[model samples]
Target: MRVKKGPLVVIGDTLLDIDVEGSAERIAPDAPVPVVDVEGEHLRPGGAGLAALLTARDGADVVLVTALADDPQGRTLRSLLNGHLEVVRMPLHGTTVCKTRVRARGQTLVRIDTGDGRALARVTDTVRAAVRRAGAVLVSDYGRGVAGTVLELLGEVRAPIVWDPHPRGSMPVRGCALVTPSELEARRLCPPPYTSPDLAARHLTKALHAQAVAVTLGSHGAAFAHAGGHHSRIPPPTLASGHDVCGAGDRFAGASALALRDGLPVEDAVAVGVGEASRFVEGGGAAAIRLQSHEMGDRPRTPMEVAELVRASGGRLIATGGCFDLLHAGHVSLLRRARALGDALIVCVNSDASAKRLKGPGRPVVGQRDRVEVLRALACVDAVMVFEEDTPAQVIERLRPHVWVKGGDYAGRELAEAESLRRIGAETVVLASVPGRSTTGLIAAVQET
Candidate 1:
């Protein structure tokens, strides 16, 4: 039950991103081409669909208006967004837009795009009504024709608008709240050899007659220019190397719209947007999209799945086990340190039965599902699994993690998981816990009050 304050309306074109990952070990005999032995594939919502999904995931109630053809890809897109959003799909006259990328090992080999690029159907009364009722509006234009109709429809709405513009898309009207463009797009908007991001932002703001413009500068962060004659640069949060940056701009736009809809000032909203985008990239970006399925409810991973993931990562796996019924600063600090020791951190949470058995009756103030969600929200926790046993010995044996981490409470004391760790040939590490931060103590103080 945490709900955002109001509904956000998003208008633009939706696309399907298909990634085919395989091994390209041999070249074709007839032609000079690498023959890829297909292994796996992934499909994700892209374009404005991705922006709407990101906004909903940020806790906002979203109404997404877009066009979709009556095709297999369109059906897949609808299925993917079934429960996540209130999608108002217009009947498109052409084929659904699809971006198919073929990757070998980890590198992209080739990409093929399929679309008719036909003009979108005109906006309907329903879309206009939704826009009128929105607390805020976001236009995620991907240079697709859908944005053209959407921009025309939004001309009459007075709500704050966050336009993520494309060079070929419809230009935003005057007095809009914000416009965001990547550095490359910014340069195109204001003409080339642009001296600095600040100048580009200022120029775009004035040309679009918008209140502000935020130009995203990849790893360096974002530059902002407001109509009030103020300009500033917002740095991104530190992120690990080698993370996939796909969908980061969508996340930034969605987060900024959410903050602004909730009444945060422009500067603060831009900061929140930058932070959200950085976290999204740091947490795996496109690679993490599959994990969103588990957010609806806790789908505790089996030991086999966890092992497969660890193997796929080709990195050391670090694991820790605890009730984690109530997350606090101590838990965050410990998890952060544990993640630093390896490429991924897997948290083994105690099941409800196990928590009740260990902590006596009236324990686990938070339910198992809620606890898993809380733990999953942490950037340091890459995966979560629930163990029914009082101790995580079974899980440890199954996972055979590279390192087993414990908090300061277990320092200098014999650990119940020691035998399991030894059997699995996993090294054990004890991290110092934050002072005066214990769930038990917190519960006691609450009861006393």
Candidate 2:
């Protein structure tokens, strides 16, 4: 079916994915295993849940049809997904699936999978109606039986269907608009000697009697074979290296469904999918999906408190430190630019004593409290911090912002707090000052007048 005006429907199983990330420095005395000093925990939706979230974030009116147990993990998933998109919950027979990845230094040390949940073989009239009215359907099957229960209904739907298959999942029904399988999954589905993705795509397309089969080849992009005797390979615009690829496949499938719904040809839709997946990986993969609240409370947050909230939600924390004595237009421009560099920006203003030490005795035309208040009034600044040290080294070390910005020309030279940034694996950014605007010059002009 080719309904093109209804909301996108994502159907399958949902999972709770947790990433416990930290630093691993030394091996334990008992065993050779590295001792990980846990830094933070990031919890987000996985499987079909993630696909629906991605589609919703792309400005689509999306609905998620999936199975969830009445458990703690299930409640958390519902809480996270409910306000974001409409969820048509189905019956689940067992516990909720929870996958925890223990990682260090941007690498996964180990993955622990739990739960034995499976969707009950019961399809409601509501699910059937949703599939019928969908502009497009994305089946993100995690092999938990949700796809199996609605397989027949999906085959009868008029809307474009994009099936993202798992190796353990059931074979796609006949006449799907697109079936996306990873290279390994395709190889597993096909017989021996069908090693090439092109061969696997063609074989699966013919055997499954589908409109097209797209075999995802990870960083190499995807290869597809259509039922109309057309086949080709689409390479990514740029290969992303050393980035997490946790949900790239789901992203590709979700985007492809949207593209097809917008009337793009299968080949072109697959190309779009490849580009989106590449960009997703380059943007920190699934970890960059910020599901947590960034709301500021009535009380002003400390640098450490702001950093903790941002990091826990998988958002970038940016910091800029200066005296901010006069709060001139140049300072405002610099603060706005720094804020644009990340998800949240926190300014570190020098304390009264610290500013006096650097700007001389008669300096700081504005007091530290008023300067902070003025800076806080700017819409670009998310939070403000006052540091007692001459340099913001101590505060920087504590907050450990992902980016540290300074307003000056110190491109090649190391900043005064460079060592502190290095210790936290943070980058330093140098922004040029606005010409003919400086606090020192302003005071001089006032004296002359």
Best by lDDT: 2
Clashing pairs in 1: none
TM-score for each model: 0.73, 0.70
**Which numbered prediction scores highest in TM-score against the true structure?**
1
Question: Candidate 2 on 1-449: residue-level lDDT in tens?
Answer: 32437888999999999988789999999998989999777788999999887766655678899999999999999988875678998999999999999999878999999999999999999988888888889999999999999988876888888989887887888889999999888888898987699989999999888899999998898989999889998998744363789989988998899788877898999998887787667656876554543443342456677788878767689899988887776787577556645567899989999999988898678898999888888656778999888899998888889989876555568688988999999977665454456888788777888
Please count the clashing residue pairs in each candidate, in the order shown: 0, 3
RMSD of each: 7.6, 11.5
- How much is 34 displaced in model 1, in angstroms? 2.8
Per residue, candidate 1 scores C-alpha lDDT tens digits across 187-236 of 88887678989999988888989899999987788999999899999998
lDDT of 2: 0.83
Clashes of 1: 0
